[model samples]
Target: MPGALAAVSDPALRAAFREWILRVADDELVIGHRHSEWTGFGPDLESDVAMSSIAQEEIGHARAFYEQIAADEGSDVDRLAFDRAPAEYRHAALLERPNGGWEFSILRLLLYEQFEAARLGLLAASGQEPVASLARTLVREERYHSLFARTWLERLARADAEGRARVQAALDSAWPDALGLFEATPADGVLRAAGILGEAPEAQRPAWEEAVRPVLQGCGLSIPAGPAREGGRRGLHGPEFEEMLAQMTEVWRSDPEARW
Candidate 1:
């Protein structure tokens, strides 16, 4: 709403850009909530604090994106975030899945951070206004997230046979949904055609793979052979997402008019 999107005069282009922004915001918000679940339950004290900090940052990022859309629509970030129904969300299914365990959470974080970094890079080069500048600023914060995940991933993978096995199992389980992060939509095509987006969402997959594959392989993890899980981008989520959404929006739903 900082007039960043005003130059995109075409209604179709604006709609597509808004959808893309919502997708990014939703992804961050859902994953941030998932990460927050570990606040008091992390395997160790440092990890607990670190995950909490990461959760705050992710949610903050979500707010930054949501603010743009909300401002454009004459709404508020809290309304855009907490007022939406489960099926209205556009986050990848990978983010909504249960944290499972420390290893699972770490592996999930590793995958997501890599994907986010790549996507942000494309956004930075998109020649868009405030959004591109915002992407550049967000990239600096994301570096710590990547580093945290990588450090923990390596330690867990090399800890022992059981640790390595656990990490591997996590990778196998998460890979399919991780791939779903790049599931393409008409919005992606629209953005690409408008020159607002440098690459379609699906086209960013290889770059994400290139970034994550080496780090994962270095940790002795094998990439899983599975098809990408789809639907989240289209607002089709599983029951787990329903439950999470119910919990996430409970307070807001209880009193939508109340300021938090």
Candidate 2:
């Protein structure tokens, strides 16, 4: 398939596509930072190295997506990734939240990896050239992310009563934010209308639920019933996000003109 930019000349559609891409990139960047927090602090040496690698892969993924947008807009990828205001980021609130505990981070990773795999599947089938091809390539790495998360989740859940309780508590706290992953935006409608996106994030919820429910249930964890915490997609986020973004962007912001 031809690149969406070549196939679809509509400026609005292109803008919407850029917005959607930003959301994907932002999710990766934020979650990658959160994952990096586990680098030296993981429960074990193997897990530490594994999570560090995952963090690098995720940040690399974000850079790839940002490069796509930068190519389209004649902008700089570093600026796109590091200079955006906190409210300008389109990532779900879940990714920006603090990594509370090993259980919390593991469960969050499990939930997110499943959603990401499904989202990438949609992108791969969208026939939007570089983006579609990129999505396909990403799935290769994402599979291992899903595997690591699931394996850790199962181990933590089965470790003992306290372990199970901790995992359950993390689920209760994270489920609402996870559901926030599918919050919709006006740009999503544009992508759907342009045929660049087959399904809006909200529309993908059922399948995501189907994919996650069994894994979570198998761990003996109950899915929490709470309202989806929305607003990140629309540029609303909490102070914690502000703090994290500051830390993430500190060096770049301090020396924007310097070559990294």
Candidate 3:
């Protein structure tokens, strides 16, 4: 683990790198939790199982990342995941928002999966040590996630006007939060200057936009014009997060000192 994460001598750069990693891990954790909620409530049996599998994989990714960070910082992974104050979380606001409906969840997944793929691709290309290897491995799973999202998106949109309208509405509502996925932060420039991060989050926005535009337009969905809903990156999250955290940490908090 020590060899995998090559030492960054500069304290600030190391701190920035940790922040970036936490953001990625938190995103995966929150979204995975949300996805897991659909385990038994999906539209059909096959979809229920598939979505559950995807949810589990996402949680696994989060665990892997948290483990890496924990090893580097001399902290425990479980504590890093559930012990942080809600405001300290670095995930995007889009991930914290409640799963409103099937269309909303599917569209959100489609948007997030694209951004994640591009983000991981950059990480994999950066030639960073353990993280690069991890990113490469995770990107493979992300591909299937992308495929799942796109497949459902296409079918729902093409099914009927009602289906298309629902998808469009979901797209419109989720657009601002989706844009927030690329909200720039101080750590971004620090990581970029250090060559630890391949591109600034904002710089990657154009590619992400281009990647999703055609698919969205084809689905008869229009990206809404609005300022990005910011704050999640800064640790500010929606009210739903309070409930989510409570439920997510309940078991752990119940026995913080108890052994399994």
Please rank every candidate by lDDT, starting with the best. Answer: 1, 2, 3
Cα error, candidate 1, residue 155 (Å): 0.7
Alpha carbon lDDT of each predicted model: 0.90, 0.89, 0.89
Collision pairs in model 3: none
Using Cα atoms with residue i matched to residue i, what is each candidate's TM-score against the true structure? 0.97, 0.96, 0.96
Kindly indicate the candidate among 2 and 3 with the higher TM-score. Answer: 3
Clashing pairs in 2: none
- Model 3 lDDT, residue 43, Cα: 97
- Please report how far candidate 3 places residue 79 from its true position, in Å: 0.6
Encode model 2's per-residue lDDT on 1-260: one tens digit a residue.
23335555788888788788888899999999999999999999999999999999999999988888877667788999988778899999999999989899989999999899998898898878789989999999999999999999998998899999999999999999999999998889998987778988878999999999999899898898879999988999999999999899888889899986
- Give the number of the best model, judged by lDDT: 1
- Candidate 3 regions off by >4 Å? 3-6
By lDDT, the better pick of 1 and 2 is: 1
